[model samples]
Structure formats: structure tokens, C-alpha cells
Target: MSDYEISNVDPNQELAEQGSDNFWLIAAIGLGLTTIGIGIKDFFTSRKLKQEREKNKLYQEVLKKHQAQINELKNEKERREYRDRLWAENSN
Candidate 1:
């Protein structure tokens, strides 16, 4: 047709340009995310470890406080007796 013949744009050129632009954009975004992840990877790992340790420390503290209460129970019951025995073994 006259329109196709008169047009300055080539169909292949337009397709190639679009594909190259999308590829570069995706590649750049992927590279940026990878770099950011690498840079902060250690920070997230250390923070997770720190949180775990704090959780363990709090758990131990709770047990220690509960043991003190169990030791104070004047009337011995099955539950109290069992807790006290476990406490005695772990205290040393």
C-alpha cells in the first residue's frame, strides 16, 4: 500500500527497539535488587540471630522466676513436686 511504502519506520526495527528496551530495563532492575540484597544480607542474618538469642534469654528468665515460685510452695502437690524435682536437677 502507499502508506506502508511512504512510512519511514521499519517493522523489524520497531520490534527490535522495543525488545531491547524491555530487556535492558528488566536486567537493570534485576541487577539493582541483587546488589541491594547482597549488601544487606548480613544485616538481616545478624538481626535474626540476635532476636533468637533474646528470645532464648527471656525464656530462661521466665523459667528461673517460675522455679523460685515453685520452691516457695509450702503445700506439695503432684505438679509442684514434679517441677521442683526438675528445678533441682537443672539448678546445679
Candidate 2:
């Protein structure tokens, strides 16, 4: 004698109603998965770009240091050649 008791519901109608609601549930899950996929892809791509920029900066720094060392060696060689020339002239 409960007031909340349902007595004559058709099983086929209940199944059909459930099937209709399931469409929205499936659609929402699909959209969520696609969003996550795109987010992951973007994260990796941005990380790779950042790493490449850092590597390029390091390479440029190393190149600058190497050039400075080469210039110092050139200056030393020129000085040594000038000293040798003066010594030969003074000996004569």
C-alpha cells in the first residue's frame, strides 16, 4: 500500500527511454576524450619547441666562446712574429 509503488510499466518502453538517454552520455564522453587528446598533443609540441630554443641558445654561446679563443690565438701569433722580426734586425 505504498504511495511510491509503480504497477504497470512496459519493459520495452523503459529500455527505449534508457537507450535515448545513453546517446547524450556517449557523446559527452567522446568530446571529453577528444579534448584530452588535443591537450596532450599541444603539450608535447610546445615542450619540443622550448627545448629546441634552449639548444639553439647554448649552441650560439659555445660558438661565441670559440670565436673569442680563435681571435686571442691570432693576436698572440702576430705578436710573436713582430718580436722575431725585431730580434733579427737587431742581430744584424
Task: State in Å the error of residue 12, model 1.
Answer: 1.8
Model 2's number of clashes is: 0
Residue lDDT tens for model 2, 1-92:
55445555566998898998999899999999999999999999999999999999999999999999999999999999999999999999
Worst 10 residues of 1 by lDDT: 70-79
Model 2 CA lDDT for position 53:
100
Root-mean-square deviation of every model: 12.1, 5.6
For model 1, name the residue pairs that clash.
Answer: none
lDDT of 1 by residue, 1-92 (tens): 58868596676987999999999999999999999998799789999999999999999999999998887674467678889999999998
Error of 2 at 27 (Å): 5.7
Candidate 2 TM-score, C-alpha based: 0.62
Local distance difference test, each candidate: 0.90, 0.95
